[model samples]
Every structure is written in C-alpha cells, then in structure tokens.
Target: MNLRDIDLNLLLVFDRMLAERRVSAVAQSLGLSQPAVSNALARLRRALGDELFLRTAQGMVPTPLAMQLAEPVAAAMSALHGALNQSTAFDPATSTRSFTLAMTDIGEVYFTPRLMERLNQVAPGIRISTVRNTAVNLRDEMEAGQVDIAIGLLPQLKAGFYQRRLFMQRYVCLFGKQHPLAAKSRLTLKDFASADHVLIQAAGTGHGQVDEQMAAQGIARKVRLVVPHFVAVGHILQSQPMIATVPEKLARALAEPFGLAVRAHPADLPQVAINAFWHARFHREPGNRWLRELLTETFAEG
Candidate 1:
C-alpha cells in the first residue's frame, strides 16, 4: 500500500462513512452524489486491499480494518481542521461555513426559527443543518465533528467537552380552552389523573417524567393517544378532551396560537435542563465559539 496511490479525498469519505455508515448520508454531508460516494469507497477498498465496510441491515458496517483506521484518521482530520481554523479568523458575516446541530424534534420546533432568523440577519451566508440527537450517537458525532453543536437534554459531559445550560424545562398541562378541564382554576393530582391523556412519547421510552412522578404517588392516567412530538398535541387537544403534559416553553409558545390553555402540573416532577454541548476540540474554534455564543444568547431570550 503505497501512500502515493491513495487519494486524500477518499480518506475523508472513509471518515464520514465511519461516522454515518451509509453512502447517501455521507454524500449529503459532503455534498457529493451517492454514486460518487460509492465510487470513492470502491477506490478506498482497492487502495487499501480490504473491504473497508460491509453493507448491513443497520446501514454500512465497518470492517475490522476500517475500525482499526477510524480513530487515528479522525484524530488527524480533527487536528488539521483545528489548525486551519486557528490560522484564520472566522468572520460570520462572510464565512460560508455550514453548521450542523444535533437535536430532537421538539428542539427543532422550538429553536430553529429563531436561530435561523438571527443567523440570516448577521451571518447570511452561513448554512445550518440538523441531525437527530439520539442518546446513542451524540458523543461519537461530536467527537468526529459530524455534529458542530448539540442542543436539548444532553448526556453528562465527560472530560474534553464544554456544555452550557440554555434553560430548565418544566412540564405543564395543556388543554384546549374549551375543554372541560379548562373551567378549573386550580388542577389537582387527582384531577390530572382522571383525565384521558395524550402522551408525547418523543423518545419512544413508553413512559415520561409524568409517568414516573405519578407512579411515585401510585396513580396512573389513561393515555388516550400517543404521539411523538408537541406539534401533534395541539391538533389532538383541539378535537378531544384529552390533556397533554409538555415543556413550559412549548406550551407557552403554542397555547395562544393554538387557542390552548396551560395549567401548572399537579405532579411534582423535576425540571430538566436543556443544554448545549460541544467538543473541547471546537471550544476555541472561532466559528464554533460564535455559534455557541449565539445559541446561548438566542435561547436565553426565550
């Protein structure tokens, strides 16, 4: 395997393939076609004299050879990127750099519009992309720089990471203003448990904070509908007597527009912290620092 026979671009493709494990996803990230990514992988396989990856039901599975190469290659690329950014200044007004944020659907609904509007006003040329923030993949994505910043409820940061608290999200009960529950000035735990509920099972975890708090008191509410996000809660509330427990930020944002009413949650569930996370490697990168600061300022306004 002669170094002269290898293309540096192929290594980049390989690196992204290791992160994404799918040709199409890697192509989208690199702005290349699926065929082009496939062709690059073929070249990489031939040059390296091994099947770097294998297609599997999960997507592309890295071979032992690829797994062996992943860490050093990622380190080299990260260091090169850091060094290049250090050598130059990032002028948000002029930089055409793209930022990828890892977040959940709720985060997208609550944060994207404001963030994009702010960026358009100050950094018009900058582009933003979002990836689903699954608990399983966030750390690896951040480490590889596939995701620039992650927002929402993040895992506890180990060393070599930076995180800032954006806000603490408290849950509130939401119902249509015309619903029977809306007549009550104060809602009790029994009142909450008696109502048919619309559960926003965003994580597919079968249960949520509401359930945990209710179980502690040995109470259970019947879930009449289960949906993945707060967006669906509005529509369900409009047509049914069902109640939903959602983040205060979401309830406040939608209550007026959706003609819904918010009530304090009767259950004493703890508020969760919404946070922003970035790698220590990107902590000093001017563009990342700018973005982190922008996110901090933008969400703090909410």
Candidate 2:
C-alpha cells in the first residue's frame, strides 16, 4: 500500500488497542471516542489489506500481520514522543551555531574586536561570519536566514525590517597628529574649508551623507584623494596631511593606533545613530534574541 494513503494517526490506535485488548481502554487512553478508535483500526486494516485484529470473547485478538507490525509501530511512537518533548531553548554556551552578520567596514572596525572578546568569554562555541552589506542584498539575506543581524547605518534595511538604536556618533575631522593644523586648539571654518580632504565615498552604507551635509552648510573642502571605505582611511591619513571627516567612534579607535588626531568639525553636522537590524521573521528566534541582547548589553548607550 502507498504510504500516502495511510494516516499516521491510525498507527496510534493500532498500537494502543494491541496492548489494551479492548476498544474502550484504547479510546480512553487516546482521548478518542470508541467509534473513532474502531474506525481508525478499520482504516488501518483496509490499507494493510489484512484483518489486523479480530474480535473475540477476550476483547480483541491480533492477527499475524498485526503481530508483525506491533514492535516497529510501537518503537516509532516512542521516538515521536521523545522528539516532541525535546527542549527548544537555545543555549549559547553549548550551541555551535554559526551566525552571519552584515556590516560596513566602519562597523567591522568598531564592533568586531569587543564582540569576539565577549563571545569568547560566554559563548566560545558560537562563531561569527561577517559579509559586507554592499556585496549582498541586506533584506533578502536576512529574510532567507543567510544573515542573522546587521549593525551599522543601513538606510536600505528600512520599510520591512526592525531596528534598535545602539548609540549616537558625531562626525569629526581626522588627520595626522604631526599635521600643521594639529597644533591648533580648534580648527577654524577656513581650516576646514581650505584643507585637502580624503573623500571616503562609502556609497552603499549611507555615509556619503557626511559630505552632503558638509556641502549643504556651504563648507566645501578641497578633496585631494577619493576612496571607497573607512577601513584604509586611517593608514592613508597617517602618511598624508589630508583630512578625513569620519564618525567619532572610528576616529577614537584609529587615532592612537594610526598616529592620527581628531578635531570636531568646524561646521554643524548631524550625528548618525548606529542601530542593530533584523528581519521580523527572526524576531522571536532564540539565537537571534540572544545576539540582539548581547549587543545591547555590551555596546548600547544608556
């Protein structure tokens, strides 16, 4: 008989009736009516093309075919019971799950080291894989469970995604510590406008707004170099006298390591809010919830 033609629930009745030997006991044990139990047994007999059980003064007697299926069917039900009772909670320390995060270069620079340190302490078995949001479709990746979380200033993650603000970061000017303008207590508007700039056109990450806002304030800089990401900006600024206007977090991290100095932007520029974003599909997932909480506890500003 085709497997599709049989209802697996019918197997439950067969196993119960075999041990109880009476339709009344099988119906009470299964919380099914006697008529339902009898009907299920009839369906099972017809599908197997045998009289699985025969009625007798002793309540019911199993046929040879029923005796043959008794062990396997009972074993299958026991396994299903165990599976249905298994715990569904996610234990970070025990889980070897690898999560994919979507981030910008700046996010990688600011968030990864500390995150790894925290994970190593509490969730050493868990691993992280990062993908550039620019290289992949952020929405599609999160939807498909390919990317677990995205952390940065991603305007594209809006419309259908959920987000939580981690902190606010201000824009500042970064330059070599030994640059001529470094000795000044505060950079003047002229110093900002006339200085040669390293324009970081971080197109996909939405950091291009820094330049747009600068232009809107009529504070235009003389850009001597153009680059795509903040990852290499520190190294370039260490050797070059040109300025890179970047977020305060990146500036703070790169300043001491790269022999760079940070100065507040002379013109008014709005601060950007860094946020953690995920698709609604994974909002209640245990792993996703754990990661989201870890980020908030580790980095979120009060």
Candidate 3:
C-alpha cells in the first residue's frame, strides 16, 4: 500500500484490464506482448494483495475487489488522458479518428443520414461505424471504449454514464395512403383494436408501448404481421393494408418515400425520450466530445 512503491504504468494496465477483461485483447490495445500483459497482471496482483481478475471459460471475470476499483481507476485514467490532451487542438477537418455508435433500427434510420451529412461537410476525414443498441452490455462496451456513443432510449443506463436528451418522440400509426384507415383524421380505440396490424418486433418477444397501453384498457390488437425490424414496416405497409405504430420521426421519414400516411395512435402512449448515452470516461475526450456536440445540434428538436 506504499504509494512510492507503485508504478503508475501498472495502474494504467490495471484500468485497461478492468475494462477489457481478456489478457490478449488488453495486450493488443496497450501495444504490449501477451507475456508483458501477464507480467503486469502478476505485478498488480502482488502490489494490490488481491487476485483482481479470475480466468474463466467466458474470459477474465473481475473479482469483487476489481469491480470496486473499476470506477475510480477509470475516472483517474480519463482525467489523466484529458489533462494530457488539453492543449492538443482538435481540428475535425484534419482528424482521422473512427467512432462506433450503437443504436436501434429506428434510431439509425433517423440519425445516420443527418450525422453523416454534417460530418462529410465539416469532418471529412472522420469515419463512422454502427451497431444495434440492445441496451445490453452497452455499459461494458462503452467503458471499454468500443462504442463511442449510443443514440436511442436508454432508460437503463446507470449512474456513471452521461446522457443528453436530443428529442421527444411519440407513437404514430403508419399505413399505405390507399389503405382503408388512411382517410381517418384520428384513429379510435375500436378502429385500432379491429385493424390488421404490423408489429415491429425489435426484441425477440416483447410488445410495443402502444400495445401495452392498449392492454391496460382491456383492448387487444389483431396483430397480423410481426417483423424483426422497423425497416420492414415501411415495405409491408406499402404492399399490404396493415397498420404499424412507430416513432413519429421514423413515420415521417418513410411517409413520402414509401407513399405512406401517419396518424396519432388511438391510445395515449407515453412519449419516447430519445437521448445520447456514453460513458463518463469518454465525456471529455476531444473526438468524442466533437461528435456529441454535432449530434446534439443536429437532432436538437427538444
């Protein structure tokens, strides 16, 4: 426990190991060989007097002590990184950093085009990659610096994460312009319950907010189609007379392209709070902050 005896570099390795539990991956990230990483871990174990990580079939699992040390160590590393890069100018036009984003199908449909357009004009050298946001393992990935930011409804993001609200979305019914219900100004509960519906099944087995709200009132929708993603909703509605309840932004985006119509859902469903989520460790990162600022300005519908 002597501060003078500890090598600060060892703490850096410890922090990386806490984020990326695998030794080989940590070595690759840190530009060290496999033996070097193992040697560092051995030193950390002796210095801390605890076997911080345990190797299992699933990879390295952090012990309770390691979990307890994760936040403070990560925060320290982040602070040091920011301090070291404080004077470094972040010129978007000259930077060639790649950022990975996590979002749902609806989110990708709504945000990617706008974000890409802005980046293309201003930050030509920057690159972007996307992954679906399941709100699962998101925290670990963000902490590990794998996902730069996630754009969607992340009500489950924990305390150490940072989030900024971009806009508020509401459920709207989508159907082909020629469908029978398209002429209705606003749908009624009876009309909604009786219509053939196309439900977007993003998760394996779950219902949308509209369906849950309807069920609360003892109404059951006759869902005739269940698709795995929101992209299919537009195509299905274009060819069939099925109604789909989707986010307002998504409905509007596809309305003209697919020749579809949008209407307010009959039941009063809760408005979706769309936000950008990232770990606090990346909050002050130069490139990450730039992307966040750009997204906040681009989707500033609140």
Cα-based TM-score, every candidate:
0.72, 0.71, 0.91
- Write candidate 3's Cα lDDT for 1-302 as tens digits: 77699888998888888778899889999999999999999998998899999999988999999889888888888888889888877899998998999988887788899889999999999999999778567778999889999888776776668889999878888999999988889899888888998877677212365567767888787989888789778888899988888889999999999999999988878887888888878878988898899998889784
Error of 3 at 55 (Å): 1.3
The digit string of per-residue lDDT tens for model 1 on 146-256 reads: 789988775545545678889887888999999888999889988988899987777732226556776888868888888876667777887788899888888887788
Give the Cα error of residue 83 in candidate 3, in Å. 0.4
Off by over 4 Å in 2: 1-87
- Candidate 3 lDDT at 134 equals 84
lDDT of 3 at 37: 92
Q: Global CA lDDT of candidate 2, please?
A: 0.85
| Colliding residue pairs in candidate 3 | none
The lDDT of each candidate is 0.82, 0.85, 0.85
Runs with alpha carbons beyond 4 Å of true place in candidate 3 = 1-5, 204-210
- Per-residue lDDT tens digits for candidate 2, residues 196-293, read 99999987887888888878878878989999888999999999899989999999999999999999889888889889998665666678879999
